[model samples]
Target: MPRIAEARDAAAPSSTEQHARVGRILEAAAELAAENELERVQMNEVAKSAGVAVATLYRYFPSKTHLFVAVMLDQIDRMREKFARRTRPESSARDAVHDTLLQVVRALLRRPLLSAAMIQSNSMAKAAAVPDTARVDRNFRQLLYDAAGIERVTERDAALLRLLVHSVFGIIQSCLNGRITVPDAESDLRELCDLLLAEWPDSFTPAG
Candidate 1:
């Protein structure tokens, strides 16, 4: 009985250990990418900084694109947790969602280089080729839905949210490319959120 219990504990530790190692790798990659251009940040250097082997890094992140996409997802997870801790009783669901997304945009813009690297990697990735790419989309939408106090998402709601996300991504890219100023990007996002969410129904019966 004691041996069996010990074996169960030993087997369970790998999951925790693996999460820690992956977290280390992500932190290392984020730090290095923030310090330099995307092309210049090497995977082996990330492994060294994370205290993991090069092969280990590649095993988790098949490519730089996968790594940065995972970073974006990590960032979203952090933001979701942060928002979860706050209270905003005064704002409507629409306003809450708008504020949440705007805050996220500002946070990313604050780290321009890192944001650029992650956004570019996300854009270049295909859902079929990179599974994290699809997860990035799903998690981000869930974040917004949660902010809006939405308990369920309909197809129409999902489509509108998808459009909103894509629009925001475009604005971010434009701002990063120097085609738009920060204020302009913020203004556009505000207008977009208002326009889309204004039509967002509180209750809808699914089509037959």
Candidate 2:
């Protein structure tokens, strides 16, 4: 029993250390991306900043695109969790949707460099073509399920929800690019949400 316990404790530290190392790499990559132009960011720089060898960085992340994609996905997941927690059972669907969109837009704005890198990556465009789109749809569907119960959702409603999510992303991108003002972007999102609610109020039950 003593030997078994010792082995378990030793294994636990190895697992924890691996997690800490990966976290350090990710944090270093984020800081570098934020501080420098995305076009100029290189794997060598990331490895150096991460205090890991280039081979180690490659072992963890196959390519720079993969690394950036992981970063964006992590950011999205964090925002999704935040929205899930902030949305309340007693909150009106429209209000919940509005709040969620605002939160996501604010997060993107906060990480402008990362957002820009994502937008600029041709690899991202290719990734978005299929698997990424499906993953995004799944995430949004889950959000919708949280806002409006799953039983109430239909195929048509799901399609509309996907459209709204894409539109919200477009609006945020436009705002970031200066193609639209912040107030205008907010107005557009509010109008879009209102239209969605009007068309499918039945899908979104008013919280009691």
Candidate 3:
């Protein structure tokens, strides 16, 4: 009986160890995702990169949609932390907002294939149930609130933010399609931000 119990114990890891292993696998998937499209990033590839079996990968993420969403959320969380660190009470709100938007744009540009894959995946029936758009809306609102000190941002302001975000997304897509140079895109974004914010000082209010 003691030998059997020992064998069972050997087969199971402590909860702490299990969490650590999951962390490692998620990290490995993120690294792989930096270079591969979300759809093309298979469980086998994640398992191989993570030094785990395909079953192990599935234990962490049961489907490609799950894995892809997890990866995007992880990346967004990291960016949120970075944005929080870079933004300060003393920083010009416009400059802070501009920097935050540019950082997001650069991240999307760095993983263009992954971005395209995510967009395509969202169009499929299986992807319809994912809370991606809700998460994105929450994230963008939080970023704007924190960076711009506009907690009660008006409907007009929210609409403007959406437009800016979509325009920036389009610019990155255009650059990825070889229609515009990165430098030109960057300059245009800065110009756009400046034009948008030029008249905002008169109406802007600091968050309480």
Candidate 4:
């Protein structure tokens, strides 16, 4: 089969029952990954834990990487919902940027192990995995824009925002993997957001 066809097949949507089964499998995977490293979690164990057969698990997630990627997709969906429910203050864009990025920092830090697994899979994501990663990345970038309190972004601002996002991810991953302390990463994210969003509109009143 062609690469495009294969990619589509790999990322194809599941039926309702299939979706529930996949969710259960991912939950099981999350539980295992939270307690053990990626390599230490076995497919058989996940199936047993999810109360599904190994063959069924395989149909849902052919490999551990795919399983983790699906979990990451779920994570991003949650992050999307968060932004949707978040009430933006009548504050300056700069403040919005600061508060929003800080939200990302706090959320990811709360589940270090689970986030670590997702990050690991992302770092190793291949062509077949691009669709899953792409959706996650798109949702992430959208969240940043929503946080900026800007419905329309100029060409230059969009480019700059993308760059800022990449930098923030690097810093957070470093902290998640223990290459740097959380405080350092948080400080860097704050500074980075401030620098990039310096042009954020300042005309605003505090929301009462």
Candidate 5:
């Protein structure tokens, strides 16, 4: 029993350490991408900043795009965590969802470089057929699900959320591409959110 207990304790730290190492690498990549374009970031520099060997970095993230995609995935996880603990505004579900998504858009647009890098990374992942891209898709779908104020999603709910997410993605990209002003984009999106989510339960609140 003592031997089994010792093994479990030892294995726990290994898992924690793995998570820590990955966090450090992602942080380094984010910091580097903050100061440079996505194409400008190099893996060697990230490894140096992360205090890991270049080969170690490559083992975790085989390419620059994979690193950026993982960074973006981490960011989305953070956003979900934030929303999970936040208070629901005392408004209709539509209004609350509108406000939630508007806040997310404003925050993301503040770091246009990082946002573009994330988009680029996802595109590269898709083109390269990176397995992690599937995880990104799942997380993104969850983001939309949470935004729609559904604690438990059904197929119909998921389908609606998927459409809403795609719409939001297209609008945000349009804003990024300079085809739409930020203010216009925000207004248009909020309006669309209000319209589409009008039928959502008025009693619904953020899960937190």
Candidate 6:
């Protein structure tokens, strides 16, 4: 008999069942990564933990990199929802943006192993090879723009935000690598937000 093989496509899930299965796979991968280094994580274990066949897992995630990148995407979605629920209208654009980024940093620090895996995958991903990688960047930018209260984005605003985001990611990588402490990272992020958003309409407000 001819050998059978599953399609090796890491496309986004379409059906409800597929979405649920994908969610389970992400959850399983995240749990495993949290407990061990990325290099130690095994695909077969993730599939067994997720209750999906090995081939099925590969259908959604062609490689460990793709799996973890999707996990980062899932994290972004959760962050957006959390921000919406809190709805801090009292905060200025700079404060909101700073707080949001800090939240992200702290969340990652809480799960160092898993965060390392996700960040490594995200950094390694190429736009052509992992299309969801672009989705991660676009969604994160939108989150920052929303925090900035920028209903309409301008060329200058976009450019500044892009630089600010890149700087923040660098800080995160440094913190993860133990090159900087969390307090220092927090201070650095605050300074960057202040400097980058100085021109933003509501970046600073007079204290009572």
Q: After aligning candidate 1 to the native by TM-score, how far in Å is the CA of 89 from where it should be?
A: 3.1
| Winning model by lDDT | 6
Candidate 5, RMSD to the unseen true structure: 8.4
Taken over the whole model, the C-alpha lDDT of each candidate is 0.81, 0.64, 0.64, 0.74, 0.72, 0.84
For model 6, where is the 10-residue window of minimal lDDT? 1-10
All models, RMSD in angstroms = 8.7, 9.6, 9.1, 4.5, 8.4, 5.5
- Model 5, 1-208: lDDT tens per residue? 0001110101111577777887889899888887778778888899999998998877777667667777888888888889878776667656766777787788778888788787777755553345566667688777656655667666866676667767887787888789999999988988887777666787554456
lDDT of 6 by residue, 17-54 (tens): 99999999999999999999998999999999999999
Query: 21-126 in candidate 4: lDDT tens per residue?
Result: 7778888988888888777888899999998999887765666767787788787777778778968787777777777778778887888887788778765767
Clashing pairs in 2: none
Question: Per-candidate TM vs. native?
Answer: 0.88, 0.75, 0.71, 0.83, 0.83, 0.91
lDDT of 1 at 92: 70
Going through the candidates in the order shown, the clash numbers are: 0, 0, 0, 0, 0, 0
Off by over 4 Å in 2: 1-16, 87-89, 128-137, 148-153, 202-208
Regions of model 4 farther than 4 Å from truth:
1-14, 203-208
Order of quality (TM-score): 6, 1, 4, 5, 2, 3
- lDDT order, best first, reads 6, 1, 4, 5, 2, 3
Tens digit of lDDT per residue, candidate 2, span 57-151? 76666556556655555556676687667626555567667767776677777777767765444234344322343454576557656765545
- Candidate 3 lowest-lDDT run of ten: 1-10
How does model 4 fare in lDDT? Answer: 0.74
Score residue 164 of candidate 5 by CA lDDT: 75
